[model samples]
Target: MRDNIILACQTCKHRNYTSTKNKKTLPQKLELKKYCPFCREHTLHKETK
Candidate 1:
């Protein structure tokens, strides 16, 4: 099943995005390069618990 997760900016520790993932298929956390308004740049966003 798919689970909802929050993505936070690695550089500024700001919660910027939300997404869903399949926990059965992928066990590891999700990471992506996304735009952060707080930082005013594209930064690495990691899944937050």
Candidate 2:
């Protein structure tokens, strides 16, 4: 099943995005490059509780 997760900006430490992933297929935390309005640039986003 798909599980909800929060994506936090690495630079500004802002929780800017929310997404889901297949828990069975990928067990590791998700990391992505996404836009952060607070930082006003694209930054590395890491998964958090």
Candidate 3:
């Protein structure tokens, strides 16, 4: 099933985005290059617990 998850900016350590994922299919944590307003640039966002 799809589960809600929070994405945090790696550069500034700020929570920036929210998304969903299929936990059963993809067990690994999510990671994406997203724009962070705090950092004012595109940064690596990782899923947080």
Candidate 4:
């Protein structure tokens, strides 16, 4: 099954579509500095609860 997850940018309200099948999983945890197209820069983000 395809997994659809939401990745929200902490810097701006930029939401990215991430698929578990396509995205690279970090060994430790999610990366802080992610590419944010809305902010036009690399911003930080945390997983939504």
Best by TM-score: 1
What clash pairs does model 2 have?
A: none
Task: Mark the regions of model 4 whose C-alpha exceeds 4 Å error after superposition.
Answer: 1-4, 19-31
Better model by TM-score: candidate 2 vs candidate 3: 3
Model 3: how far residue 22 lies from native, Å: 0.4
> Compared with the true structure, what per-residue lDDT tens digits does model 1 show for residues 1-49?
8999999999999999999999999899999999999999999999999
| lDDT, ranked from best to worst | 1, 3, 2, 4
- lDDT value for model 3: 0.96
Candidate 2 on 3-47: residue-level lDDT in tens?
999999999999999999998999999999999999999999999
Cand. 1 Cα-lDDT = 0.98
Tens digits of lDDT, candidate 3, 1-49 = 8999999999999998999999999999999999999999999999997
Candidate 4 weakest ten by summed lDDT: 19-28
lDDT of each: 0.98, 0.96, 0.96, 0.58
